[model samples]
Target chain A: MDHLSILENKSIFIIREAYYRFRNIAMLWSVGKDSTTLLWLVRKAFFGKVPFPVIHIDTTYKFPEMYAFRDEYAKKWGLNLIVGSNEGQVAAGMGPKKGSKLDCCNELKTNALKQIIEKNGFKALLLGIRRDEHGIRAKERVFSPRDDNFKWDYENQPAELWDQYKSTAEEDNHFRVHPILHMTELDIWKYIKRENIPITELYLSKEGKRYRSIGCLPCCSPVESAASSIDEIIHELETTHTSERAGRAQDKEDAYTMQKLRSLGYM
Target chain B: MQDQKTKCMVIGLDGVSQTLLSDYIEKGYLPGFKNILDSGFRLHQMDASIPDVSSTSWTSFMTGVNPGEHGIFGFMDLRPGTYKMFFPSSKDVKAPAIWEIIGQTSGGKGSTLHDKYREGIRRPLKSVVLNIPQTYPALPLNGVLTAGFVCPDLKNGTYPESAYNYLKSIGYLSDVDAQKAVEDRDAFFDELFLALDRRAEAFEHFMDNSEWDLFVSVITETDRLHHFFFDAARDEKNPVNKTFISFYKKMDEVIGRLYARFMEITGGQGLFITMSDHGFTVLEKEVYVNSWLREEGLLKINAVRDYYEGIEFGTKAFAMDPSRFYVNAEGRYPAGSVKGSDKKAVVADLKDRLLSLEYDGRHVIKAVYGNAEIYNGPAAASGPDLVCVANDGFDLKGTLKKEGVFGKGNFSGMHTRHDAHCILPASIEPGGRLHIEALAGFMLDKLLIQKPQRR
Candidate 1:
């Protein structure tokens, strides 16, 4: 098999294994290229149907285009979409302008996801985090576990050699199942082109600027690129030395902030 | 200005240390190295990878990355989540090698090296890589390659398929019979000399016949010789001392011949690099780290077994060959006992205990490094939690079947990380500490940056 097929098969196997093992499971969808590709993979895995609910922790700070795309894909893919938000934090006016990006992310994203997982009692939450995204994320396991407090103990992670994943978690803890952890940004684009996966139009070049990575509108910025199509994006990624997350504001705060953020359960 | 052909030649003498080479050169035994030294090549001491094994060190050298980036921590690694062991081959290397970096097309984009050459049109460089360790079952490249030690089959070891026939017809011996040294010393020397002759012959053939911008060949018989006959090589009164010297003299002649050919090919303008993967020293004691861990109650084996399957769930930490330590933490191992919260304390306690270890009133371990201190990359998480570096004269082994903490093995020499040697052309000046990993980048810069000057 080719490299993409191998990656797809591994991801599909992990998704299937998580489904079989977890009592209650859900997948996180961010309406970004990576997570959208993952959403496509989930449908392909279960034969044009998602077996579990797909959750999106909405900070309400995302681009309107992102919300539109998410809503459209949710109906088109026939997904049991669960939109989660920390209404109390939003009501309190917690945002990037109010405090540090770290605190903002924790309040809107981490806490919102915590509430969803707590309310749903999900034993596993499939994520589309790739190792090549960030340094701290690079250290993540295919089956990572979070504590009852939703803390990621990255320092002492479970050993995941070859295909063996840590399927079991302690009581009150949940596994952050990363199906596409091994795929790189380039691989995702290549797979998206090969599978003809539809992505948000915001990713394409608009006046020589395109979102290489999409998050809340206040935090993520667009890079200078002329990549209006999947092929152009692939070509751009092939030659670009800039990181996929280089345009994100939170990661630029400090070197250790991402590690600290991930440890506190911010994906 | 656009016509000068830039070429680079790297001669790897496995296990030849800086101190030993200097001493031999002073004694006029290795005239070939002396000639290079006379020809304005500066000898710099280089640091090998942690644990000082050939597989990790050579991989580090070739890929220009640490074990963390390359994902080859040692020769043998545990099949993660299990006690089963498997050898990490070239296929397991996570980073692009020097050759791969120079050989890649613009279409192959994901490899880390391609990012550097993105601005310009890349012309793939042809290389002749022969007998470099850890490169077994040769992968397809824009060059001819024959893998070095641990290469089980000749047909599988050679690339391009046609080179295999040429090698076979030339009676190329991949490696010498190390076992013969234990059975009969005289026959072992004969085998060693024959292997060296065959290797030199093959190197000469490639130097003359192959069209390569980068040529690399390693003489690995030196490492085998040092492992078995290091004492003889060092001592004048030993029985095989003369034979050992003769072997080096013969190797020196081959080096001279290769150097002359390199000069002819490049008109003395090309970059010529000579290096060893790691140095060697006479073994004072073979320290079994696992046995010490067992004695200290940190490790528990169910019974005497050949493999790590004998380890029980209660084991806090275990080791693989040559001082790679891993914590048997919960969720990592099938029945790991150490919890995530206690992993730091366990590793700390183990490090302290290892640092304080003494053998015959001498400290066995020189330094102990945490994973974060030495390694920084994607693959760091999969490496050893704590890598123990041994002091001189103490050879650290991770063998589980060993009966005691310290004993003498068949080997007279053990690998040392710091004394590895590199001889570089005087024109290039390295800024700081010379590491085995940096050589690949140096070679890449010299070869790729010297693109034909446009008039």
Candidate 2:
């Protein structure tokens, strides 16, 4: 079979495996191309219906376009959407202006996710994190176990050789499932185009600028590209030397910042 | 490599087919394999994937699943619905690998996230894995690991930060540079032998250092040797024949030593399995899959843009590497003009024609499988409508740009899915004719290896 089929099959298998093995499982949707493609895979895996709830960690600092896209697709896909926020921190004015990018992300994204996990009692949370996206994420396994606090131990990942992924979370501890961890950014875009998957308009080029990596508005930046279409974005990824997260402020703080944030429970 | 043995060890001899090994064993060259057979250990012909490649076959061996389940069909796969290609890594494997299952039972959520919420590090049986294909950026297994082919760097391929230093201190080379091999023939042999020696040493060191349940190490030199000097092994008069046999003899010695050490360590009670992903044969012709499809008026393209971008609408069908053919039905391809109702008919017609394809009176394709027959999973929607399994001598090539339909090309050898040899202890009966997937269950069953504990 073609490479795409292999990639898609493996991911769907992982997602389905998680579906059967883990109870109280929810998918983390960032509403970006990768996660949207993941949602598309969920639909494909489940035959047009998303059996589980989709958790959207709304930091409230997202691009207006992102929120709009989220709402539209959530309704269109008939999604059981759960909006998560660090309401306590958001009320206390915890954001970029109050702290560093990593701190803000922790308070807004990670902590919000932690709260939602506790509130929903989700045992396994499916994510769309890919290995090629960043160095810190490159070390991830398919069935990544997260503590109740939501931190990721990048160093001591389990040995994953066979098709058998560990379903570690029992009763209360958290487990993060990345069905698309093997996919590259280019592969995501290609899948997006193939499935005709939708994304926020922010990714499309406007005035020769496109959001290669999408995140909260204050920290996220677009790159110079004329990739007005998914096809174009895919073409550009073939030869581009710049990392996918080049425009994200959290990454630019320092090389180790991502590793640290990840260690401290940051997505 | 490691003289110390464990309870269960998988010795992978890549590309050593039934025909070649049997022929060599008959000549007293492969005494190690012969010993296994003579000791009442049966060599089951493990059926690999249709377009058997190391990446997929090894994965099947470790995962106990087909490509449809594991999702690794070849060394490189095109991005879904796009013509662009990407090499799949270990993370791409959706199914749990043998080592991962072993690790899962052991404990420690790979993510540090568990450190705060979870208590205790559960120690399962340790698995010292080495040089398995498609396993890159190795994660911490129960024991140690050094990844195999397509590993870009030693540091990235090794688990535990210190393994890199160990490998580096020993002057270990991951793989032989094929280009340099072409430039200097003698240098290639030196590097090949040296890499093999170092890999053996590293595996030995890890095995000796740790007490483990499962140990697997693959020797990929057979594949490399076959790719270049396959004809030499077949032709007795070739200058490289003696050299190839000597190398095979060296392999026999290594395996002999490993077998003896394994017996010594396990007190002759451990299960030792020697297997290969696929067998090797001489490449007779290179059949350009895409160009052939183009000839059949299945694809329409213009050269003004890139290969993928060049595809035009009304493209009924197309093919990818090593015999993956897709019917461009509506809702699948962006510019697809073929109706969904016509897909089966198109696939049938394509299969009929493909089966009839002949090169100089010899059949090019032996069989054409519809997706429904081969793919038995939810991800079948993404697969090719038909898979063209080529005849033994016909090396199927998939490139928009090719010299011709079927003739001489780059390599001297090709991969065959059938006739792959699997040597396991007679105590573990694999029912009858076994496929690569059965090896996993056998490894788990008779070996008494279990997956990681669920909680």
Candidate 3:
């Protein structure tokens, strides 16, 4: 077996475990390369069918091409797609500018997610979060349970060893299942190239810069690269030393803000 | 009891196996370890992880996961979809170490929360890690961090920059000059003892200086000493054996002082643990994996004679260091020869041949693991399709420069999968069979408590 196949098998096993474990589970689809590869793995895990909802949190600030890609694949795959948004907050002008950036993120993304979880009663949410994407996420478990009020107790998390996950959530608090938590950003692009996973054009080099990681259009920027094709991206990542999240504005807000957002239930 | 501050320490002795330790203890040469045995729960015999390379084993120990999970298989890994080999750094590790998962304190050791960049500060450090492998170019750990073997140099290996000055002031050496070790034995021993001496100083320096919940320090001299002087180091009559015993005595003293100080700091309420990434054994023969493959008509090469650079259209399979193998699968590589359909049979046949391999009337190879049998992760795709574990005394080498299957190298010792042991607090018994990765969970279970108040 090849390295990619081993990765695929483990991911497929995790996806199957999620399917078997969670009663009301959904996958968070960011339409990025990582999440899309995750969606492909999800499909592959269930033998070409995603048994649970594919939830896309439309912050109303995402790249336009992302929305187009989402709709195209969602329809093509016959997905049980759930497009969510902070529409109420967006209507009241909730964004990075309203008071502090952290507060705005909480209002726009975390609060919106909280509302969706409550409305849909999602007991567990599978995210495409990879440890290499951010410093804080490095500590995340394959199955991370949120405390009451959706708080992430980062200082103390449960011990998940040998695929034995003690998935006990606080009342009304859901579990965050990261199927790709152990993957690096490089692994995602490689997996994408291997599986032919669909991704937004925003990732491809435009002029000279390409977005390494995508979040909201306002907070995300691109790095200087000529990696227009998937092969080039893989080759570039082999030598590239810069972080994937370097261009994320929210990350620049402060080193601690990502932890703060995560604690507040933000992805 | 309620007022006892939480604390724990993991002392990583690079290659001192339970077998070796038992021999040393029988000679009354390891009083420090003897004390640990009398006090704590000795694991008797904990197996090393698969492949049993120092980097992968320590990584498994730290992350509580196998190579398939933590994504570090050996000292080096081939870049995905390319034949290019890259050193696997701590950054390449996909899973978090216990320190990473526990939330690091702000790099600022004493900065008041309200007065500084208030953006992020984790639970005030509960840990200090020093001289551990796969931790080169040390991450900005919450507490102090000084990396171990394969650390590029003194500057890049130590973290927080503050620790760098202290290291520089004492002229602390991070690792032995490995190249120098091979070329000059006398110089190697001198550098080795100096580095060992400084390592203890650094450990003492940090433990005395830093406040922590957990403290870890791994000594790598045992591994290096065994590698160069394995057979002689054990023989009491050998001239260099005195130097070896002297070094062990020095280490025993270091361990004694460290345990005493650490226990004092912990107020008798902490876990003081000791372990090794893997064990050491005599290197009777070195098996050149690629050369063996070429002889078996499995691998073909061109004039360059390099594994990747010399490959041509006719290549069927190849080998990587520490006994990892890969097939030339098309669609995965640009000019890969093997199609996806024949991969299973091809790998299985390869495994069978490897298992049957022998030299000097001895089964040179103990086991051949299909990547599926050993690993399960995304990076596993990029790994060698097959990993061959050699029997004791038969070291596996990936050097394509060798002319035959059997050869002798300068190395006298090689890594072993058995004999790796650990000592944990007596209160914690992980019970039944155990591997190196189990210790991480044991320590985690110890620290599992009411959440630390958020900064």
Second chain only: TM-score per model?
0.96, 0.90, 0.91
Worst 10-residue lDDT window for candidate 1 chain A reads: A258-267
Angstrom error of the Cα, residue B301, model 2: value is: 3.1
lDDT of 1: 0.84
Q: By TM-score, who's the top model here?
A: 1
The lDDT of model 3 is 0.76
**How good is the docking of model 3, by CAPRI class?**
incorrect
> Which 10 consecutive positions of candidate 1 chain B have the poorest summed lDDT?
B105-114
Chain A TM per candidate, in order of listing: 0.91, 0.90, 0.89
lDDT of 2 by residue, B1-455 (tens): 32233368889999988888888889888888788789868777777776677777887787766666667776556577665455677777766676766556323213211222123223455788888888876866767888887676678789877878888999987777664444577887887788789878887787777667788889988888887778889688998888889888888888887887887888887788899999888988878877887888888866434455456787888776667887877876666768978987898888888988888998998888887787654455666778877788888876676645776744678888787888888877777776887776666543443332335
- Give the alpha carbon lDDT tens digit for every residue of A115-191 in model 1: 99889889999999999888668688989998887778776687877777879888988899999999999999999
Give the runs in model 3 whose Cα sits over 4 Å from its true position: A1-267, B1-5, B104-124, B303-307, B450-455
What's each prediction's clash count? 0, 30, 11
